[model samples]
Target chain A: MKRLSILMLLTLFIMVGAVGAQDAVTVTWWMEPSGSDDHVQELIIDVFNASHDNIQIDYQPQESINDQLRPALQAGVGPDIVWLAGNAAASQYVAGGFLLPLTGYADAYGWADKLLPWAYGAGIVAGELYSIPVTYESMVLFYNKTVFEENGWEVPRTADELWSLAQQTADMGLVPFPYGNATWQPSNEHLMGIYLNNYAGPDNVYAALIGEKAWTDSEFAEATDLLREHIADLGWFGGSLEDYYSLGGNDPTAMFASGEGTMMMSGTWMFRGLGPAFEETGMEWDWAPLPPFSEDADMQVGPYSYDLALGGNLGVNAATEHPEEVGIVLDFLLSDKARILELASTTGFGEWVIPLRYEIDDFPPGTDERVLRFHSDFAETTGAGRYGYTAWTFWPARANQQLWEAIELVWAGEMSVEEYLENHAAEWAQDAADGLVLSILPRE
Target chain B: MAFKIDSRVGVTSAYRWRQILSNYIFLAPVVALNLIVIVIPSLTSVYISMTKWSGLNQPEFVGLANFERLINDPIYWKSLSHNVIWTIFFLTIPVAMGLTGAFLLSGIKRFQMVYRVAFFIPYVIASVVNTELWRTLLHPRHGIGAWLAKQGIEGFDIRVFGSKHTALYGVAFVDSWHFWGFLVIVYLAAMYQVQPDLYEVAILEGASRFQRFRHVTVPGIRPTLVFTLLMIMIWSVPAFDYIYLLTDGGPAHASEVLGTYLYNMSFFRFEVGYAAAIGVTMALITAFIVAIFVILRRRGWEI
Candidate 1:
């Protein structure tokens, strides 16, 4: 009877607290600014506040946000809205029970149909929604159109043609891919995902992601060897491995702009810099999906698949005092498609591009044609059940770190790909056991 | 009469005790602050060091497993060894440069302030700016290396940081460039207080400039010298920023030190428990360094 009375008393207190909180409740969100003004967030937040009476939205722009949020989340206190690097990052928070499942909110808001399926699915961990991918991107083959035309070179569509072009370009004393890791060490993974998806095929890659296929499989081995040989042994990636490391930050990007390389395989984000880079050198540039790089039909890219990435993810904090208010704020943020498009258009369409469902014509007037074409291709391909995973977005944190860093050790000849894969499998196994591995959406 | 005398003595003792209590009460805020920030965190870290944590996940108690893994980890040993090398480099090169600059500046009367400012500019500038300046200036292709090569400087064509053999030393050189200036200012102030009569006596005895520097100048600044040694020892083991900014301990962990390694483990790899072990080990190493310095001072080595 005493226990029952204590429970009753606790319930009464909670009810009273809820009633008190309903008046003048403030829902807080911390976000990294998209641009100087962060017009998208500012405009939407202003609109929300103007529409609401007591529930005010508190949005704070932050830098070094992951570092800030980690301690806050562990202490069971933070902004009502939790920002993370991606869905892969949310796995840890999900494991800790720090993130509130957004499924109820998603159902209430009907966000499942509102976002791109791949992006919406990226937010699901352990068969439940825990995050929402705010920004989405993909990797593609950026080529010097001028260089291709001048040399009468065809854009390679298969493994043979790609290697032949690489050889021919190297023979002429030029960088083929012009890829290097000096500026961003994780650039290693950009090429890794490209080769993995293109050479091993997205299906095999997805199988490994879902723990059905092993990292040491023959196709993966072939991909690793091909990359290792091209980068270090054959000296085709800019120069030798050392040369690649020594490529003074943006030298490869500069080289691409100067028409020194046949192509540079990189992210859509590269478009922002490419215009100025090409302008300086009077070079015209274009892009296509990175081609299939395997002879086996099983390993070839079926139709097409773009390697996907999210700049970051947002989840509601489970420990927050105001879950309902936070959900309302999230619904507004995701639903405001015009604000997102405006931000994308103003920011030149990379960092501020949210993964809401879109039509090509919905883009405001003066949207770049290249941007539209990419969207059209991505929408059509992904709609037909074709998409690949970027390591940063899909791999667990440790595996992601190892994926990039250990590859350098292999290239430097300190470790073989077999040894690296063995370690990778070990890390993946631990992540799997710990429930830190993210659920990859099933292929159609 | 004897009872009254005993009562007076008791009162005096009680008053003394009260005075001591009041003194402690005055110290309470600072003590409380230390307990909150330092003592509590240190104790928590000890607990964390024993567990397997991924920062976000509930730390699973694995008792000394992390330490065992660290002991068996070659990367840990390699990183630790780099820290030691970094410490040795700072102790020697910066100390020598600082001593020489101080001694020279002390002797010169004209443009002393100008010389001090010139030497101190690198130190005074923000670390990012200083690092960026060196990163661009020493870049193999874009910087002086390429320019020198064009001017028929053949051997300088090599990449300083890209090579595993030279990466650690290259970072150390940049750090020393930014750091030696502060050392100069400290050593120069000490040189000023050194008895000028000793230098006069050395000069009268027909001592060479080098001899004066060795005999009078060196011994005169022994306290400052020892203090700087202590400072550099503590700072060098955690030497992160310049190296982190320059190479990120990279190419292939060629320039990896304990600090960068710990950071990578903690944040990048999300091996918080393993990282905590590394952190505790570093704290122990730092304590040992401080202990050595304290012991020497108590033994009157610096005094």
Candidate 2:
């Protein structure tokens, strides 16, 4: 009689435990594959699952997140949380009522205090936070240290110095800035944004973006002319325009690593690929702030860097059944700075957007010193009010498209600078009138 | 007796009606699939073309405004002209190459199968792989152009896909290189079906090789030739992968075709309404070509 009672009680306990396990909330997360960072994301997901018993996450890595998310959201079926490319994409989803406004959760979680002010401001649409920034990026001048040393050239800090160095580099048979836009024409925006912010000054470009000034303003025209001269007449890229077009995105970095090119202008995100390319050649490379494009001290933003909102912006699907659980997952992902830094240190996944509370010296062991210094320098420069803007993160869709297309025509000499500026200005003005322009955070 | 005969006829007529209804039931799945995938999307596309939509917000009824904009858009006209040029090039070059290849292969016997497989291999390869292969081969630094320059050949280092003047032709050449082989296999099958007596008669009449090809082989393969031409005209309307992968209609809109333009407008610019109008225009062009072919057939032309 005692044995029968014990066996019955044990079976009942086993059944109750199984029922409890089945009741755990399942949250689906859609992430845009970031090459090597995908494994880091998977690791984070596993850690989260192991730490929490009430919630389970199913991670789905998508090749083209926006392309897939748009249709699925329209059909009223999508993952609980999605990774958007930037604030521009988040605004589109917010307008469509596909994203859940996270104002209350953000306040409860103290996200505003934890996140950088500019990053927090970027997620607001019509006075409500609809997304959480997961990554940050900026453009800088990348140069081959070996080549610069061999040629006895100092990194230029002013517009005049830059032009002089470019001339000397050309005389030495090395490309001053190796650029390519044939396969990926939109990459032209990287160089254009840098020049626009540096030459025209961030204030004027900001005004133009927000419709307070015209693109035909003299500052913009000056920038356009400078680009044309470099591309067409000067040929600072070491070849004809045709040769520039023939080169692919990776070709410039490869050339620079091989000591065939002196300098390259690209985003910090390129460090992932450059790290490996430089490793192969045992070549030393470093970055410098962009040279000022204006001689007037007042016009320059003190080596303004064209900072664009990049990386994944996590948002909750409005139709998700588990909103609370999804919010919890987002908080776990963004709030854990230690784990993020540790991952960044160990795996070179340094693109996380959260402002670190810990000291730079506390970075985990095995972190690449070069990568750490790069991020530290980027944080310092952007913190000093030298950050500018990028079109992909700010401009309306149509205006942004026209910006690159018009510039290509200008580069090909098919359209004059005046015509290009006027055309873009008209399109931008109309988009502004339609309330299609995204909110631009004021310069700090 | 007359009433019995009437009853039997009524029972047979009722059985025939049941058979017809069962046949329709068997075809319902295919008809439903066609309606869902083809008929519905086409009709929806036509409706979407008349509205201003960004694929995110509610589509505003703009009624023909998109078409009006397209009429004034220079890029649209440029893309359309490129497509026309593309059609003409494929009609001449690839078709001629396929015919010549088929004629030679049809003459050989020992290595016939091997040659056929070798020629068709490119057609079987994926577009991305094929494009990447050509991109490397035509690269200005390390490709054939660079090698020729290394050998002291002047003017050989020209950037083919990079130059606006040559980008369209370069993409067309790559696309043709992959496509001509399929046409060869098709033409060879049709050539084999031709009766041997006709060739014998031409040979007995003291006809030269060219004369025999013109008199016997040409007429014998007329049906396949006409069919291939029609297919080429239709396929050229949506020629996207090569040009898109190669130049993306770029280096200053030099190789802009309607297909790539439509894709850019829809996905990149979010001008779905304008893209739909372009799509509708493409459909009309295809329909017009089919109508012309039908008319020719109705007028007693063999094609």
Candidate 3:
């Protein structure tokens, strides 16, 4: 009996050792979710961990990704996965040797084929892939259909129609576009990108972006002038520029839903917010592509052109202990398209509108058709090479900064459009000389 | 017995040395922490000020270039001027308000605690909450401005925070409203420390209420007043959070301070060295102000 008891004890010890040895490698990835709940990260991380048996993920939601990233990267240590605000931000990390070169992982996973071509190329730095664009977005016009119906307003498709409608809206004592930068100062770039694309024409703006033409050209000047007229003088935005500056982000949505404003021009990211806002107000909301503000008949596909933007990117940290595990995680995130879309359908599309090939039919029952429609519109517009560039994605940091901040001066009429463009050109020139410019994807 | 006493005295000397050693031993952790977190970082920042860094790469030295750029930068000068205006406003208006409130409250014996608590509530409230409260009340369309306009009040719908002329003042006003209660509480405590007999004597001498307060109360709280001033002056160098949260130094940077400029340069533009240079300038300005106070004290000023 004693011999049997000793043998059992030995067996139990051996079993415990084996179990301890089999523990999965933990890969840490901190998420900066749009919502405080971290619901998207919770879902994705849970699914990824369950599917991958050999590797587990430790999810941490950060309050401020920028505040945390700056110190952690500087210290040669950070989470296994990195979330950057944009592809441009990822490039800064790449420059600092804080991000891993993902060329090998891309080859192994065929990431180039899996992602949209431009999305795949967005992370390339010094001819090496250092980041991956997890999400692609565009600025769009979201209008209150309830308000539109009440006013008998039709969605404008041309420069003349848009101005006439704006004028009408203004005359009715309703703000034409209740836009502001009170919450996010960089929001000015959204309008800047819209004006230059729809007015300057996507092709001309593209040429200017690639340095084929100067920004001080007549087209851009006209766009700038049009912006000044509508935004500054006409006070079409929130009754006056003063009122506009006073308004926060949610205020515009509320104003639109409550019929105070007929329309609000904002980014696709606001898709998540429109439902609850409209539902509460019992107002129907719908979106239309920002129509081309150009008079040129020669410009092909003038209407329905979108200002393409990369919302954020994912990169592997160079200091990560489990690089191999991180690669599997990256592949799971990027390649598992069906699951991602399912999650997006479950969560409702906003931050998770990734750059993967979408099977829109695969969305579950009772999905909001409005979000799905924007995706459809976006893909169709970009596919036809009728896409413009977002200043955040295309312009280098300082130049992109000037694009938003310096426009305030122009709005105040302290600086002329010509001078503003010149300043923008100078910053762009300096950024280009520093090799900080992103290699833009050529229009098809 | 004499030899034994000498031996005990020798033992006490060794014991005193041991106690001294233990005090340092107890203080070692805190001292080390301060060195690591504050002193070392401050010194490193001084070095960083001279370097061209992106906060991502190793810093490259570029002596005095950032300072030269800052000198030429109109934005920096604009921000500095706003900061000066903020300091002047804080020192004058709030100090006067605090003195007046505390003197009036000190005279009230009944519900004094209630009044103190009520006045102190705003100070204890978070800056974010205070800013939001003021923002809602001051909103051009949806707030009091709009309501007054609805009642047929002309020009009451002025956008205080949105207009360039009033943005800085608007933010400063909100910040001061939050800060005023703290000053009142502090002054009230100092006023208590003044002798009751001195006020009685002032009354007997036929001093008016204002005269009594001016002569007796002010002189008695002089040290506390000077201390508060010194703190405010020093604090002004780093004054940013309220302004940043409220206006973000916007409407073309009408409320921009040195702190916001440093933050933008460091984080947004990734011009770390330039930001460090701005930080150094702020520190130097603070040091210079402190030196003035120190000089005053050295020359036998009571404060």
Candidate 4:
């Protein structure tokens, strides 16, 4: 009887609190901006505020979102929504229980069905929805059509042909790839995926990550040898391993933009930035898979390694006083297709102008035809893998550190691929001993 | 006689008490500020040093683990060596250039203020912006250094920064440009204060300018030179922003000073405890260098 009275009084208090609160509640949001194009977020916020009667949105642009949000989230005063890169770091948020579980909300609003299956699936961590997909990007090899045609070279379709071209180009005293395999991921990701897809194929690549085989597998050994030999012989990259940091993906894109180089391995997103340059140079540039292996074996450019399911998402603070109102805001902002398309079209106020989803017609004023056709072929062929696919994400931080350090040795010429792989395996096992997850894939 | 002695003792005791009271009164604000600002934060950091916290909520205690990792970590050692080299290198070039410029300018009677202003201008500029200016000047493509190569100068495309052989030195060169100015101004002031009599006596003896500089000017400014050297040694260990902005401790951690390394350990990898160990190591290094300077001073180095 006493409990029932307390429950009734509690319900009454909530009712009073909700009814008494008439002032417009302000919701703070944190996002990263790229000065000009990133301004689209401000417009979206303005539109949302103008249409809403009960809530106001305040946006904060940060230079380093991880550094800022990591502290804020832990302090329990984080923004209602945050923008984060799609990677293992994003998984850390979900794993730490800092993010609100949006599954219930998604189910209630039918968001799961509305979003692309792959896109919606990307943000799910431990079977819980933590973020919604915002943008998608894929890494592909871009080749200079004009340079190749001038050289009378057929576009390379396999690793051997690619190497042959690199050698031929080196003979003529020009940089072939101009890539240093020395930087951290996405660089490592792009390089390793290209090698693995050609050598072990996608099946083995996934298998290796999940412990179906060893990093010292013969195919892996051969691939590493092949890559190292090419590096030693042709010497494509002009800068040393350390110079890798100075060379942005865009640096090569800039090179491709000018008619200086024949090929660069980069993402389709960079195309938007480089399209004008390509047009000015009158060079037809297009994408291609890392050439498949010559061995008539089971492999193609292993499915695209990282596809964006979600760049970041908005989540309400679980401890906030206005959960219902926050929910209404989220529903309006994310669930409405028209709002999403507008947000997409404007490129989220310049955060990403290339919408995650776009039809060919939606290309910006000077989009390249060859570039689109190559991406279409590549996308259709490659399977999109999860982002944040670093060794440290699954294991203890030490294991990841050890792996990165070991790879540096390879570039330094102190260790071979076999030795490096063996060391990484040993380190991973050690991390397992120290209590860290080593596998996230399904068991056979 | 006894009364006189008693009165003297009483007066001394009273004087001591008054001195103590004034000292306390003078120190009260500083004590309060230290407790409120420095001491409390330092204690908090020490406590955080034992945890697995990434500057985030409820840090988990992992005592001695971070230290153990630092002891074994190769990059940690590599960074330490870089810091030591940086500290040693930072001291030499800046102090040498400063001493040389100070000596040359002190002899000039006219336009002393103009030369002083020109030398000190670089010191007043922000380090990041200054380092960036140097970056453009050193850029491999269109940099002034590269443009000189177009004149058929061999080794002109020197790409000094991104090279493993030259990256740290490149950063050091940039930092020296910022640091040497202060040393120059300090030395110049010390030189200006020297009595004209010393130079006059040397001149009367028919000593040349070089001899006068060595005999009179060097001895007169000995204390200033020692102080500037000690100051440079102290600043070199913790001075990270220049190296960070210029090279980002990269080109394979070639320019990894203690400050930038500790920052990367904490911010990049979220290894707070390990970063603390790095911080402690830095403090210990600074303390050790300061002690050496103190010993040198006691040995008649005269700073």
Candidate 5:
């Protein structure tokens, strides 16, 4: 009995040893969901592992991805690849010297011509490709079809028609427009996109941001004037400013879906969050270009591009033992552009046309139809001439926060538009005083 | 007798050595923990405050520049003022309310358990959940306060946190809800131990309830009140989670306290050095207030 017991113990130890000796390559990726779906990471990992022989992709979802990434990169323990929401922070990360320059690699892979020019240029900083643009985002008008159809009103093709329709909708006792001023992106960008394109004209707005003209100029004042009119004409947002954070992108879309408002201005990424409910509403809704301010003006719509840059990239730590392997894996991941788009669609991320190898004509199952419409719109618009480039996108992350906070202050009536402009100049002067300067020329 | 004395001395010396060794063994874990968690990080923060660290890369030493910037930063000054006001407001008002609540609860004989639980519920709830609940309740349009406004209650229709003038107060009122219960519990526990004989003796001498409270109950719980007040003063200075979850120090930094301002500096702006300076200043201010309370307590004053 003792000999048999010893034999059993020896066999168990050997089995454990054999299991521990299994060889696998572990690659860590940092990702924050740019859309509503939680299954994006899981689905991608499952498929990638199934297709590969000896590789495993580990995903980490972070709340403040930037904040955590900065510290981790500083500690020389950052991930192998990072999926980012192409935004202003991506450039800042590249400037911080934490991202691997990918210009040569992107060219070698023939990815330069695959992505849109705007999307590709958005990720470049100081003549280096720090990141690959994964997705494109834009703010657009979402209106209640049932309400408009019931009123026998055509979808407004001009700014005047929109306001006139709003008045008519208000007379019918429905909230004409619903948006919040709490968040800079949802509140300011949403309003600015429409106001800048339709009222002030996108060219003048872009020039002002790049310092070709001062923000206090007459054209800028006209923009603010237009904003003020929206406030005066439109009813109060359903919730208080304190609840604005929660009401930001998703809740407001939900409000529009539930018939709380006739129209809302929100980002395209919201399609996934509102998709299921929209399917239930059985309400026929269609996308339209933002109407022109005058009859002669072109239909203006602002493109919301998530500029994936090195500022948001995951850099393999130089300190890691398997640097070559990590690079190889990252290269493989970026090589498969079709898979990236598929992963994005599954993740409920906004439509992005990756300019890399393998283009799938047919979208995978679970891809929302609204997303397809946006993708086509992106192809038509190319986001040039109509939309003002994101000022936050080209600047450092710190500067962006300051700008947003200043915008919030102005919106809260703490400062006048004039004071806001003055503060903007002072803030820039302070940045100069602190030895930070504009690093890139503004897009023409 | 001399041999016996020698043997006793030998035994006592051996015992003394063992006792010292055992005491060190018991204290080793705690001392190591303090060194690893608190002392090392605090020292690092102080060191980092003297540098130009942006939560990334090597921190370059730029002595006193961060501190100078903090001194000139208007937002920092405003946040400091808010912190000070919050401390003073909590120390004076919440303590009194707590005392009043405790005194009232002491009179109830039946349903006392239910009352205690009711009063303690807010204290036990997570601060974030409580802040969210109060934010909803205090919302202008679709909240309880607004519902009251629809029923003809004046001043309740307006958003409690909408204006700069009332934003901080709205946050303060929400915070007061969670804090008052803790104060009540502490005051009650202290009041329960007050001598029954003193109250009876005061009553027999024809003292009214108010007089009895002023002389007996107040004197008996004075020490507990002072301790709680000092602790509350320290806590109010760094009170962050409630404000962060609710206001985000918005409407033009009207509701900003030092903690939120510091957080924005570091996490939002990536200005770690400036944030650390703010943190050090907060620590100093907390220490100074605590020292003042200690000094006043030593003077046996009832403030």
Candidate 6:
């Protein structure tokens, strides 16, 4: 009898082990290398794995995720989850039927209430949610505090003040806006967004995006003219088109840090490299929202709102065999506030796009105060509905590309501002008519 | 006796079949590899050129539309023109430099091997490293240009790769610098094979150095010269890495080459079909050049 009982127990144990083995599912994820910290993703994966037993997350870091993902997905063999740059990129995957609709996952995970309204809306295409944003960015005017104080240059708040300062700086044999577009042409879009939103105002820009207003409208043409005049007058980095094309990301930042330039109009992504760069020069830096393009009272959006962008938006593959497990992995990655705070602390600034419910105090101890303040200010201002469109995050892909190329032509004097605007309007209208535009929220 | 002869004939036939089979067995691997890597992909690319594919979804059939777009696209024409310019520059500059270097080196008796190795160093170095070296040297701010500017030299202060007027030439110059040395080694090998008697006869006939080089060396290396010219022409069609790394065909399509343009269209713009069409166009150009060479050869031209 005793021997029979022991045998029964052994059999039961074997059955349970087999069942547990069958329950285990490994989810594959391909992510681009995080610019801030390399090991933070590994650490996140480790924590998530430790917290769960039924699911194993396989983390792979790819240098060029889109380039690799395209062929793999085409072969009907891709990772369970892919980290995309933004909704603009995710929409392409969705259109190709490569990405699974996150609508069901969003509901199950309570993502709608968790994410910012605009961010949540941005990920939707034709009323279907497709991506969950993991990082956010915005272009702003970064000035050297030391340089400004030494030169008695007040930070510009209006278009007149900004241009006045630019002219004065040019007179002093210094660059006003140390812009560089050589390495990455798409960077031109950032400057365009700033000028368009501030000059033409967000409403006009939004209207133009949805095909309700023409880009050839006087406001857009004026914005282009303003940008062209600035380019001609200032001539970028070293005061020539050659310098503008030759200067890369680091060159202009280095110039600003060393007081060779007064200000740099760039995205918050620059923080990752700028911290180390500024360390050498002991240059203190601060960011301000871009100045209004005009002081006209009719331009309602200027002086209040600024361009906002999201990065590192991610989605699950429709072809993934383990959708449930992939969802669980994504939930863990997006919702683990403690791990997210830890990553933010290590990186010295938060590039992560967390739910608005998380406050600065929720961050890990030893997180830099300045970085926290920057995030907090942006969040508060954006939450208050004082935010505009960023081309990379919001514009349709073709339109966004056209914007960059057209701006280059205008700057090079190959195309007139009117012609550039007309071309943009035509392309945008076609895209909008084809139902290619992503969901966008109107400014309140 | 007749039956015995029939058996012997059967054995001889079997032996012949076995010999043929052994030859095929030896060739099997290489033939299979070529079919898999080259022939299969090339055929697929030709098919893909007729379809609209973003490389993510089902490729939709859109016969001739991509080609039509390519014809209408100004950027395509512009990039093709740049490739033509690139071919001309490589044909003239690198070929001249290589021939001159080979001729000068062939005449040298002391430290000949040292000179050969020294010239070949740049060719052996990775293109990325070579491009970076040139970028730094040509940089407007902290490079030789800046140093020269401090000495009151003005022209060097301007950016080479940045200017639309100069970007194509600047990139071609860098590529040529890295490539000309390879031509030097090839030409030198060909030059060494030429009999010394021909040169001696030319010298005896009171031929000047230039005359001897033009008359004897030129004729002797004609085959090599033609081969290198063909290679340069074909290679120039697919010239990508240097231009891609240096300027990325940017600052308003100033340095756009067909290779970089096709790459951008395929990857960045997601116009894979259009890019494949461009590829087909390039292949046609290569084939035409090859056909011309074949016809010339058939017509009894020495090359």
Q: Whose DockQ is greatest here?
A: 2
As for model 3, its CA RMSD to the true structure in angstroms is 3.0
Give the candidate number with the greatest TM-score: 2
Candidate 5 residue lDDT tens string, A27-118? 77777645533554555666676665556677777777756777787777887676543444554455466666767666765556665565
Q: Which pairs of residues have clashing backbones in candidate 3?
A: none
Q: Which residue pairs overlap in candidate 2's backbone?
A: none
lDDT at position A409, candidate 2: 87
Q: TM-score per candidate, in order? A: 0.92, 0.95, 0.94, 0.84, 0.84, 0.93
Per-model i-RMS: 1.6, 1.5, 1.1, 4.1, 3.9, 1.6
Tell me which of candidates 3 and 4 scores higher on TM-score.
3
Which tens-of-lDDT digit does each residue in B1-303 have in candidate 1? 555988999988999999999999999999999999999988888899999998877789999999999999888898999999999999999999999999999989999999999999999898889878877787766788878899988777667777777888988999899899999999999999999899999999999999999999989998889888988888877789888877778888989999989988887877888888998999999999999878877897754
**Residues forming the 10-long window of minimal summed lDDT in candidate 5 chain B:** B156-165
**Model 2 lDDT tens row, B102-174:** 9889988998999999999999999989999999999988899899999998787779999999999999999
Residue A137 of model 2: what lDDT?
A: 71
Overall lDDT per candidate, in order of appearance: 0.84, 0.83, 0.84, 0.64, 0.65, 0.82
Docking class of 1: medium
Worst 10 residues of 3 chain B by lDDT: B1-10
> Which segments of model 2 are wrong by more than 4 Å?
A1-17, A303-306, A346-350, A353-359, A365-370, B1-16
Pairs that collide in candidate 6 are none
Weakest ten-residue segment in model 1 chain B by summed lDDT: B154-163
Instruction: Give per-model CA RMSD.
Output: 7.1, 2.5, 3.0, 7.4, 5.0, 3.6
Instruction: Report how far off residue B48 is in candidate 4 (Å).
Output: 3.5
Chain B TM, every candidate: 0.94, 0.96, 0.94, 0.90, 0.92, 0.95
Interface RMSD of 6: 1.6
**Can you list each candidate's DockQ?**
0.54, 0.70, 0.65, 0.26, 0.35, 0.58
TM-score: which is higher, 4 or 6? 6
Candidate 5 TM-score restricted to chain A: 0.78
Q: Which sequence of candidate numbers ranks them by DockQ, best first?
A: 2, 3, 6, 1, 5, 4
